[model samples]
Target: MPTLRRTLGLLAIPALALATALPATATAATAAHADTASSRTVLPDAAAAGWLARQLVDGDHFESVFNGTAYPDQGLTIDAVLAFAASRSSDEAAAKATAWLAKPEILSGYLGDGTTEAYAGATAKLLLAVEVRGANPASFGGVDLPSRLRSLQTTEGRFSDRSQWGDYSNAFGQSLALIALHRTPGDAPTAAVDFLANSQCADGGFPLSFGQPTCAGDPDATALAVQALAATGRTAKANTGLDWLAAHQNADGGFAAAGATTSNANTTGLATQALLSGGRFGTGLKGWSRLVKFQQGCSADPAVRGAVAYDATGFNAASGTRATAQAVLGLAGTPLSTLSAAGARPDSPTLACPAPATR
Candidate 1:
């Protein structure tokens, strides 16, 4: 068994993987109608978290059913757990989801079967998630996740996957590794920090894939890197990454992926949290507004109301789960590295749009 490090319920979402727009001058009429349509007793964050909790399979986890086969979606489930923690709502649902992730059968598949292969990113992400839930990662499912992740570190300090197939770890995995290690009693190795810092593209953003012929900065990767480096006391490095992200923000205050001009909730959500962590308050608030625009209000089906859409096309069952899970972080103004579920509500609340006033 490895040395157990217990972080107090400060859970975070992994690199699950966003839009833009103004309400005042650009579209005053649309803004007023949106406000009236979204009149709710519950806060948007709480309502969004509530809708997310209700989507869990068995009120605990999510399933990726493919061709009639139901496979446990531990990654997506962890995203929900972190989102619940960030919003400080749906404590019961978060706890249940966390518990489900700790099951030996479920844990094995996600972190790998232990004997055959181990996923560096999944291990790091799970470590971070369980710690946020206030659980002991060392003792989770009878495996030491932190220790397991440590074993996968490369000579270059990047955490690589251990598999017969190939090494699939990337910048996202490296960021998660640094973050999870930072929360523990031990500091992330200096070598690991150096490796991450050295990987920054000339554009000041981090790339989704490492060692490409040419470095291409990705918004999602850059956001996670900012949070990780900042959490580890690398403020200057983190700020440079933030600068890159800021440079890429759309006119509507949301972000788009690299080479894509359209803003979406998933990227914007991650970037919003990074902005807050990096002290870019004005930009972060703008990101929040963009995320709000992606949310489905009461006019949509009740089941999907409060759920965020991926882009302007509106919410669909396939993409809504991932979109909402990521968006809640921004909607709640909760940064991933410091998210906690303490003092959260046990129940998920519904959006209550008041009846339209008759003219």
Candidate 2:
């Protein structure tokens, strides 16, 4: 999947070695939110994560197909890493995916070689992923991911793409940049936080793109922005964004992208996590309830069971990967800023279906 970003915007770990490698802030943050998943059993979360793990090629990476050719999909792979960490299941898959991403060639392609302009969103996201897996971002793939991302920041404080392709970095990029940097040495800079906080639309939500003539709220952008703003201690801004999300929640408890009336698993997953981050547990659970309905449960074909579909229409291969990757975060009820794989299981666990009742 190219991600909703391509359509609209854009778009791992160990144990003792991990523990020693992780920053104190990351360790502490992980500890504080460790119980976030306790409010619900989430047997479905585990199964969904399990099914997601199986979709990775070679138990490590995912591929994006174009026409008849397949290319390594580093972006989607990172999404899987986050989902695995959030669910606290499929630890091995998350670690393996992390390692795969840390490869020199792969890392270079996604983040860009110095000859090519570095991507703010990709760098920030990868930094967060490596950190979440408890790996050192400074030394990952023999490059300093955090430092690299910092270098992309503008004088005005936005973490922008230094790209020949034009700066496609959006609110999602800014949010990831803030969140990833929050775990690093000095935390996100004041200017960067202010830049994002100030960009909020009048509707009490964030826009997908910056520098637009008129700001319009986008569900996916607003959700990710809320997490970053909350992590950075911009409580007022975060709460306002949450208010916009709450206002947009459909009667079915799911959320749709900006300007769309139909609810989708991707937006619901993100908005639910935002709600949880804002401490709106009841509202978050409502989003969760709607999100799970998009999942293919026991009634689905064996290959697709536990996979989340993009919409109520049900599961299809095209949208399955992205939907499942994003949805698991909400289903597991873990906010992205504090997500880690510290105590996750090494194996993917299948759904446990109960026996049919006898007449």
Candidate 3:
């Protein structure tokens, strides 16, 4: 039998100030306003946005594919959450993030799926997430992490498996690892930085992997790398990536995943995050506004509400929490903010989160 997993909890505090500050009439009036006018061009204040960020921060836990069981490994999810949470100065969120990093599974690897070796990129992301949440440098697993990180490096200076490398050279893995290395307060080799600069495609975006036919940089992957580079004081390289992203904006004021056939909340959200990291907040704000419109409540559909859903040609009722989380993540630059605002929370203990077999 297939096992069930409960990844994260939904802890929402009511936005009493937001609700009370705006009377029912004003709220309804704003809802009735046109998308252009209703979508605030300015990024929401960090405090105003904290509630949503918390939702994103807490929703990172998902079931481990190994051992046919569920476990909370924030390593995979905390980078993005910490970015948003740190911006808001959320003390509670910081504490939770710190606790997750201190978990043994992060550095030593989780005890499932045959004790798979921890990936360099995953470990790097976890470390950055912890720091963003306000953990001390000592809170990291100490000198062991740097040694393990070095071990994952290829002779070419890129990280990840040589044969099946995916997105490492192109800013995804390198970016996260760079942030971890930068935060460790030790001398890092120049080769790693050199590898990132060399991986840039002629079009100015990073690919999902090195030497793949598709050199098109994905918005989400690019965003991850952009932030990583920025963290490591590589502002110029980060700017180039951001420039490429800005050039790729669609006519709809949003971003396409790669080739620009369609705009998606996932790609758009990442683009927004990247832009924010690069200090291009104005450009990111426009894209985010467009995304918020796309994620407007699912009143037109019954299976999902207040969440984004996708289908090639027909609606798929089976898509569940993962889709919701992705859409929420895509919309808010963090997960759970929009979901809470819409009053929908992930159902615990086997919340259905199925992605399409093929994207």
Which candidate gets the maximum TM-score versus the true structure? 1
Task: Give the alpha carbon lDDT tens digit for every residue of 120-216 in model 1.
Answer: 9999898988878888888998999888988888898889988888888998999998998888887687789888988999879999999999998
Per-residue lDDT of 22 in model 3: 56
What are the runs in model 3 whose C-alpha is more than 4 Å off? 1-60, 64-84, 87-90, 105-107, 110-116, 137-143, 161-170, 230-236, 294-359
Candidate 1 global lDDT: 0.81
1-359 in candidate 2: lDDT tens per residue? 11211211110112224434556578542432221222113455677889999999999999998999999999999999999887778999998999999888999899998456788899989999998999988899899888898898899999888878888888999999999999999799999999999999998989999999999999999999999999999999999999999999999899998889999999999998789757887788788767666777555577987788898776889989999999987877677777888998899977544456799
Per model, how many backbone clashes are there? 10, 4, 4
| Candidate 3 per-residue lDDT over residues 147-252, each given as its tens digit | 5566677777786632232333345667767766766667445688667766777777777676677566777667766666666667787788889888887776
What TM-score does candidate 1 get on C-alpha atoms? 0.89
Instruction: Estimate the TM-score of every prediction.
Output: 0.89, 0.87, 0.62
- Look at candidate 3 and tell me the lDDT of residue 111: 15
Cα RMSD for predicted model 1: 7.1
Clashes of 3: 4
Model 2 lDDT on a 0 to 1 scale: 0.82
RMSD of candidate 3 to the truth, in angstroms, is 11.3
